[model samples]
Target chain A: MEEKEIISIWFIIGCLLFLFGVIIFAANVLDYYVPWSGTVTVLHEYRAGIWWGAFLIVIGLVYSIAFNPWKKTKEAA
Target chain B: MLGLIVPQLAMLFTGSNIISLGWVDSAIVILYFIFVLGIGFYLMKFTKTGEDFFMAGRSMTMWIAGLSFVAANLGSLELMGWAAASYQYGILATHWYWIGAVPAMLFLGLIMMPFYYISKTHSVPGYLKLRFGDGASMVSAVSFGFMTVLMSGINMYSMAIVMKVVLGWDIHFSIWVSSITVMLYVVLGGLLSAILNEVLQFMLIWLGALLIPILGMIEAGGWEKMVDRIHQNFPQGDYTHLWSTLGSFQDNPMGIHWTGIVFGLGFCISFAYWTTDFLVVQRVLTAKDLRAAKMAPIIGASFKMFVPLIVILPGLLGLAVIPGLVGETEAIATGGHSYNEVLPLMMARYLGPGLLGLGITALIAGFMSGMAGNVSAFATVWTYDIYRPIHRMFAKTDGTDAHFVKIGRWTTIIGVFVSIGTAYLVQQFASIMDYVQALFSFFVAPLFGTVILGMLWKRATKAGGYYGLLAGTVSSIGMWLWVKMDPTALKIIALSPYAKDMAENMYRALWSWSICVAVTVIVSLMTKAKPDSELDGLVRSCTVLPSEGHLPFYQRPVFFASIVFAVFLALNIIFW
Candidate 1:
């Protein structure tokens, strides 16, 4: 595969991760007001939900990374 | 008259007599000052150029920048202010943290990152100059400098009064202590010492602030008990629900109708602080590269999301336990009670001696750190943007760059005195929050007008930039004055007031910012651009550098954690 194509694929994956994380976060907020008869503990719920959202955002940023031309161009032999 | 004497009489009643006048607290404050001074003195060797003074030589790593960003933004204001809001407004006040600030930080990360990548300049104003022209840049830089000075003054004043109240020292003496400590460090080291001290101060503040809610929860028989207590004492509508007790469109405290709160708090306040404030921008500009700067605000935002757990929750708990503590209204009704004292009062009443002393010390550290951050940023702007320009324009051949650096140090000393003076003058204001917001609104709206338009609009001319800024400033001030003085406007302003003499100041600010943005855009479109030759170096800053492309990917763990945070926010907003 071409380098640009690989970069584009990574970018798309990163975006998907971010969007999914946001949706999960929005769902958690809905849980607070909706009176859902869930058996989940508050501490466990907060930890699991918040940490998961944060994890996805981090993944999104990581996956989107491409080689910077400025530093690399300077280092070329 | 009521404002002046009421506070003094209240101080007489609640003021700490056991702490003694400037003995233990004084020593702690002085030692902390000396430690900061040592950091500043150490950093002086590194202050060799304009970039070093303004942006810490642009060499700060992501972690240090991230931590310091949180520390600087948190300050005593966040500690005291969030707690006070929670004490009065209930969990709804947490909206400022969760909905307002966090999203703004993320938006800044996603959308504004491209600008940071393009504008490699040390100051936001410099970036504006590159994007628009000299006129826009100068107006922004000047207004920002003015706003910084105003805010620093208010912060110093509030900190001094808190120390005076908590430590039983004279207000004048408290001011002197606060001023000297901050000045000693900031004047010497500039941005480097400020960031370093902020990192340390953040730890102290977190430790101090976090203990309050945890201890309060335990004392009130844990979270369930605390909630029960709140439900019992407060009306059914006021207890757990976020929006139930909040002042409606017709009854806001600061003239902010419900819609105003939605826009002003949700958009204007967040945008102005995160996007336009030089102190925040300075941190971003000092990052090692574009990617670090872009990521830094997100980290700060993530931290902001959790801040309510430490700062705001304790205040709500304090409200639940302390009967009749119905927000700042009841607190202020009992003559001489300041909203700033809510957290301190809770500490004194609930916490035991050892922990109480430690907590008070932590609060002091938070206040000083904030003051230090302000002074350091003020010094950098004064030196780089103002004094250096005058020196070059006037002295030319006589003054070398080193001479200007020395002048910068002197300017910091002057800044300290000015801030102290402003603090004393600001005492007559209604509330700390009102005074700070009003001051910021006056300066920030106009500057935001110029910078935002300049960056986004290619047709934005120097003439248009100047006119737009003037129009925005004039209209905002006029609107503010009308709300204050004009009977018709006052009635509109008073629509939100719950009781007589209760002012809701938010309306003026909300309207003012809206007017500013509108005027800037309209005026910029009508004006002619400056010559391309004159705009060359200025616009170059907005051109994305090749180095930006080399940025590395985020770590997998961090990516995963961010996803979790988003889920938490969404669930809380939807269900709670």
Candidate 2:
């Protein structure tokens, strides 16, 4: 009998983080040019969105790849 | 009148929403909802058996179980309440997390896990059934089942209020959306799904909340400077000192003495909650092996030690950044910021749109997971301890495991609706909410007395256990009513006229616990003890604990617990 594959929770977290990171990072980039009217935080000059977004992207990619069910299935095959 | 104009003034200052989510932020929240449901659906295929539904098939890794254990306790209400407490009472609030929690968590890991694991009980009530018999178990199961659902309802209502206050969402919208989301996932996947999402929520909470402290520290210069700044704000206040101000009730903002801090909180309430609360212990029971089960809470304790950084530090930071935040009553009456708003206000001050959404999503996740934890535990206790036993009582034949699993699914659905009904009840009568919360302390402290005695003392009779529990619960409620009826009664129960509400709670728990132990001892001595043969795996004197000597010293639970304890001590001293 063939072994059934299970989707990893880590992969889901990674994918979600990656998507959120890209959007947040993109928002930061757009705001740099547009100067949006949203409530700018006290430490806006630090660009936390850019740094935090990049951090999430890196973590997300690492986890998504490491725990990817499709990759494990291919290896087993 | 001030009330009439206060509404207009509040709206003027607060604007439409404290936070306005961008498209990106909304997308992230939507994605979170989708992913949780996806995990639940994905796990449904593996959740066919009764064990799978109730215990996650006893297959969780230590990391997953540990994180889930802690995450289940880290409800948004706790996060916000403690943050408010840190502001109101200063760093003394850290005691609740450290000395109050860490020791109890370690005790559960080092001493208690052996019996729980070896006995193969599905719930804490189930453990009682093995040791004391049906009477004690039924009392525990019914109270736990009742309280868990009420707490879930309270959590649901709290989340709705937070959403309304923070983002201007409708209370109905928040309640229905989040409750249904929790219901769908739990009904689909059971404990495994809950554990998975709890781990995810823990991560999200960290990611979402970690920034405030990091950014706050930078803004406040450093810990030393932050302390100095706090001292400058309230020069006479002992805001930064943990143990120094704990000498007397009059000495500290919390109005608590060291004895109360140590004996009342550190020993009684902490042990009762961490060791016996099925909501958290259910997570540990998910561990794959005895070693994993034992190690789970130690890992949880290590993480729990750092929670004050996110929970307490923000309130401390608020003291430095936004002074003059009033109490809840004044905030409502005068259209001012309250201590409870410290976290949200700080988030608004630091996080812009994208990060703001993440923080909101984290809060929502905490609330939803809390609901899931309660409902899932309720389902387990209801099925194994209540429904099954009752079914066995009436029927001649035993039902199949599949029958119980089917019942568990239906119970989850029913539990959510009951919680929803209770949430509406709380909305109608807010004072009932306070009494319902008090119900927890009433049962937990006394029940802990019964369970611990039953586990440790071979002479603890079944009648002794039941009566002790009943007496403790009644005495706790009697004490609560005494304090409620006459405000002066607090002086007698708490042992100090200057003792604050928190201190009264601690001392009440202490008295009730003491009463429970004394009653149990007297009753057990008076009654016939269970035979040694009957005490086998249930009592510590009878049970043979599994040896971990074959494993390396570093891999032992004691090794990690010692390191965690060392860190806990260092933290207390540093903050002291």
Candidate 3:
């Protein structure tokens, strides 16, 4: 029987975080060009979306690449 | 916390929806659901054997098991409810995270994990059957199965209500969508699927709620300024101190004293829930080896100690920024904010579109993971403990492992339906939700007594274990009834007229646990002792535990646990 390798949860979390960071960071950039309406929370002026998004992207990329199943499989081969 | 009361109470304070998600936010949530279901589908092929289906083939690393162990307990209701509790009771609520959890988790890792790991039992009930006779195991299996199903339902109902109140989503839509999502994933990949999702949920919970404390601190200036502002808002309240206000019932907002906090919550309820409750224990049991199994809960405790940062900080921020939040009935009568709305209100205050979506998704993830944890655990206990025993007794033959695996998968489906049915039942009679939470304590506290005695004392007879569990459960239920019928029973049970409902719970657990220990000891003394030879691998004295002495001191479970315990002590002292 062939040995099966399960994908690491870190990889999944990383992918999602990276994707969300892009979307959020892009949304904030767009908001600068065209101001959005409705309740803009306290400290919105600080642009938390951009910074938090970048933070997620960096951590997410680290986890994703570090635990990627294919990389482990290649190393083993 | 049983993860039901505050949400059930929040059901009363209905008004206009607090926050609406933008298109970007809704997309983030949708993406989360896709990923979880995708993981479940991907893992299906690997889940062939009964062991794979039920215990993830016991191949999980310490980190996976550890995170899942803690995440299973981090339900949306716990997040929202405890955050609300921080607002209602002040910093005293952090006790549930600190003293109430850390010690018990460390004790499990250091003392109890050895017995549980070496015994090779699939469930906690399986361990009981090995040590005590069939009767004790049957009682535990039934009570656990019953409560697990009820808890899943309560989680479903609580999420639905929170969604309706917060985002104007349909109640049935929230319940069905979340339940079906959980059921499909659990049914497809079994415990493996559930554990994976739990790990994912844990990460999402941190990332989602992380912004709250960050933005909250920024808004309030800093920790010191936040404390100063909180004091300015409520001059008489002791909202920042952890232990100082606990000296007298009248001194704290919680109306609880040091004894109740120390003996009742820190010892009795914490030990029972962390050590004996199979929901969390099952996660640890999935560790790949004895070392990993022993280390899992210690890792869990390290992460668990910081949970109050997200849960309690929002509540404190609510006090500083949005004061005048009243109790449930008062909020309903006066059309004001209730304590349960603290987390949602904070999200509304701090989170914008893209971030708002992540916050909402985290809440949904918390709810779904809780349901998955309950449903998966129910399937395991029901198949291994309840159904298989009956099958063997009647048929006089042990079933195939494949048959058991099939039974487990089918039971997962059935359990979800039963939980959904329970959700509607609870919606109709809301008070039933409160009892369901109380009912959990009834089983856990007593079961802890039975399991502790069975593992430590060689002379504890099967009959003694059975009767002690029965007596303790009955006494706990009796105490609950006594208080429900006459509210003044708090004075008798808690030992003070000033003691509140929270204090009553702690003291009741302490009394019930004491009764259980006393009964088990007396009964064991009278009954015939099982020989030492028959108690191998089950009791401490008879069991020759594997030595970790050859391993380096730094790699030992004790070394890590000690560091975690020191941190636990420091946090308590710093917050004191």
Candidate 4:
């Protein structure tokens, strides 16, 4: 494919992902609530710790891959 | 034990007064300064040429470029500004992150990366000159310079306010302290020092920013208690519905009145930071090759996507915990206007001694990193674009390049002082965010018009470029004035309450940006293009070279990881 075509495809995919992400986030905001105890609950409050750990793991994976492109390229070469 | 011990530790470490601050805070502050200065000093070894000073000899690795891009763009203003917005606007402000930044960043990374890849110039203005002619380049360069100076002033002013209020230092004294330290390093080390210092500052800011939310969550009786408190305290609509509660489309903080937010996120913020800002562009320019520069912004933009968590989340958590805690009366009364204080207030309330001091130190580091970046960019531009041109024109009879470099160093010192002075003066007018935004909004549209259109539109001519800029500026200013002077006109224009303050003053500055592009295009269409020979170098910069065999296999994996991030962000918004 031509470079312009690749860029246009990526742009469309990115916009779709972003729009869908927002819709999902907005829906989550609407559903946030407390259990039967008649209190309020925050999504991040309960899940922050878990999310933090997961985020770090994901970051680590991305970091490793981005920094070690040479290994894959070497094999390709 | 967890709650009581943490508070006690915070009190011991991050006491209100400078002297009362713990040894660790003092130690970190002192050590960070020394480390930054040491980096600046070390970079002297590499500063043998003007290219090294301005662009690090154009040989930086992708990693270094990527980190510096994030560091330069993130700055202290972003740290405090986003936090404050979140504090005031509730969870809706997270729109900037979840809705605004993530998509824009990905667009920049995936779609626009190729453009930057092809554009092989050192400055964005150079690209405009390549695509159009000298006139377009000159206008862009000047507007960009003006915006940088204005932004620098805002960043310095905001930092000064924090230091003065939080540390009880005098404002003038804080300005001098911050300005001198940043100026000294930037003037000596130039781009090299700025990048190295930014890397260190980024690490500090990341740790410092994270500590506030984590510790605050623990203090508010863990996540469970925090949520309970928020629901109990705030009314139903405030915390839950992100966009609806902020009032009319005009008065609403989340309203579409600030189309600039879209323009900012989509075009100006990414394009300017990635393409224009020398502090950032210098990093990309320093890349080992074209591929590295192309990849660096993607990395940087990805890093930017995560910033809402670090900066904006704390503000959101603050809202969730203490709705209306920062009373609007106090927010407006003390020129402390806006929710900028959210992070600082949270720090004061939650973080204990050792961590608090470390956090404050990090805050200072963030401010200094931004200030240093601005000073370095200003100095480079003054020396290269302005002074160098004049010197070549006149001093060809006798003056030396070494003399110009010496003058550039002096210009940097003078520029920092001027920026600090501007910061002090600008504070008297408006909120930090408003002032910075207004200042940038004026220049961004015009500059973007010239660069984007000049490159993309083959029919664009020199006469069209000049006329387009003129029309954009005039129309925006005219609309702004109508909004300001005529109260009845406010209804017609749909002015926001925040914008109503300096009616004549506000709209002129605010709307000028949107008009710039249309004006530029219309004017360009009316004129004929110059010969292709004249446009040779202009378009060449936008040409992408064949990628060297440096394609990292890991990028494919990382691309998937970014997708996962998008999914996670989606889940957070949907479930909340």
Best by lDDT: 3
**On a 0 to 100 scale, what is the lDDT of residue B498 in model 1?**
43
Give the best candidate by TM-score: 3
Q: Residue A62 deviation, candidate 4, in Å?
A: 18
Q: Count the backbone clashes (under 3 Å) in each candidate.
A: 58, 0, 0, 24
Which ten residues in a row are the worst by lDDT in model 3 chain B?
B1-10
Tens digits of per-residue lDDT, candidate 2, B1-576, equal 111121222233454566777777787789889988988887888788888888988888788899999999876466677787898889988998999899999999998888888889999999999988899999999999999999888778777777777788887898888989888889888898898999899899889888999999999999888988888887878898899988888889988899999999999999999999999999999898998899999999999999999999999999988888877667767877777778888899999768888888888888877888999999999999999988988896689999999999999999999999988887777666767778877999998899899889999998899899988999999999999899899889999988977788899999999898999999989999988898888899987888888999999999999999999999888877
In model 3, what is the error at residue B175, expressed in angstroms? 0.6
Candidate 2: true interface contacts recovered: 0.47
Judging by TM-score, tell me the better candidate of 2 and 3: 3
Compare candidates 2 and 3 on lDDT and give the better one.
3
Chain B TM, per prediction: 0.85, 0.97, 0.98, 0.83
Q: Which sequence of candidate numbers ranks them by DockQ, best first? A: 3, 2, 4, 1
| Per-residue lDDT of candidate 3, residues B1-576 (tens digit) | 434344545556465788988898988999999999998898888788888889988888899899999999877577788888899888889999999999999999989998898988999999999999899999999999999998888888888888888898988999888899998889888899899889999999999998999899899999899999999999988899999888888998989899999999999999999999899999999988999999999999999999998899999989998888888777778877888888999999998869999999889988888888899999999999999989999989999999999999999989999989988997788778777888887888889999999999998999889999898989999999998899888899999988887788888888888888888889989989899999999999999999999999999999999999999999999989
Task: Classify candidate 4 by CAPRI docking class.
Answer: incorrect
Q: For model 1, what is the alpha-carbon lDDT of residue A11? A: 41
TM-score of each: 0.76, 0.96, 0.97, 0.75
Candidate 4 Cα lDDT to native: 0.57
lDDT of each: 0.60, 0.86, 0.88, 0.57
Q: Give each prediction's DockQ, rounded to 2 decimals.
A: 0.02, 0.44, 0.50, 0.03
| TM-score, model 4 to reference | 0.75
